[model samples]
Target: MAVAAVTTKRKRTTARPTKTQPTTNAKLIKQPLPAGLPREWYETHNRRLKAMRLAIALLDTGIYHPANASNRRIRTAAERIGIHPPSETTCRMVRSLIHYAD
Candidate 1:
């Protein structure tokens, strides 16, 4: 008696295509500042600068009491200079300017 052999073929699996975000290949170049943007940037810089200057003045004037006093003064001065609710970056700079007497 001869036995019959059965062979099964395996199916091949194909990888699914992945979605990709569209991207630009052009080199990035900074465009010239618009007429209004430079002035706005300068004004912002001026306000932050004024805040720093006032903080420095406070330090120089011997008003480092409670530490926060100078910080508050800095905030107030910033507002007085037309900057409302000063940025944390500017405030941090002001805080860093403080010096303590040994």
Candidate 2:
């Protein structure tokens, strides 16, 4: 039985489906007002409180806070803040900041 199992080879007949990412239309997603912020704020704003706070901290320390920054968290925060998706350059900058953080 062991010899037969070792001699046998299996070939895949169909390709496995790759992981699909969730897509959301910025227009469709609901933006909730964060405490102390304005209703129209999301319309004009791009960054979230955490990102804004991080930006402030970065200005003082000249570094990003690792604990607060994550790719998903940043996107999620932005979605909550509203406006539209960030540019590729911005995303790259934020991700790079994460590495320099902590």
Candidate 3:
């Protein structure tokens, strides 16, 4: 008498799904205006005030001197002061204020 051969198949395991991390963009996100400032200040005046203050601070510290006039550095300073760096035309206005303040 010959006995029949028995065969067995192994069961495959499935991988578990992983949770994905949230992606963040480098663009600045808008924040609500501070309470001390008027609501309209965010729309019109606060940005200019912050930019001028930043520019004046740089001039006071000799950061924007002719020998070291760096638009990149100025932009960084403006950002630190919570103002988006001015466009070329607005930068010209900031520069004029800088000149007049000296």
Q: Give the candidate number with the greatest lDDT.
A: 3
Instruction: For candidate 1, give the lDDT.
Output: 0.59
Name the better of 1 and 3 by lDDT.
3
lDDT, candidate 3, 1-102, per-residue tens:
234334555666955443342235334546575678777666456657655776786787676543353566667767766777766655655666666665
Worst 10 residues of 1 by lDDT: 15-24
TM-scores of the models, in the order given: 0.34, 0.28, 0.42
Which regions in candidate 3 have their CA more than 4 angstroms from the true location?
1-50, 64-68
Selected candidate, larger TM-score, 1 vs 2: 1
Scored by Cα lDDT, where does model 3 land? 0.62
* Regions of model 2 farther than 4 Å from truth: 1-73
Question: Please, what is the whole-model Cα lDDT of each candidate in the order they appear?
Answer: 0.59, 0.53, 0.62
lDDT of 2 at 68: 50
User: lDDT at 55 for candidate 1?
Assistant: 69
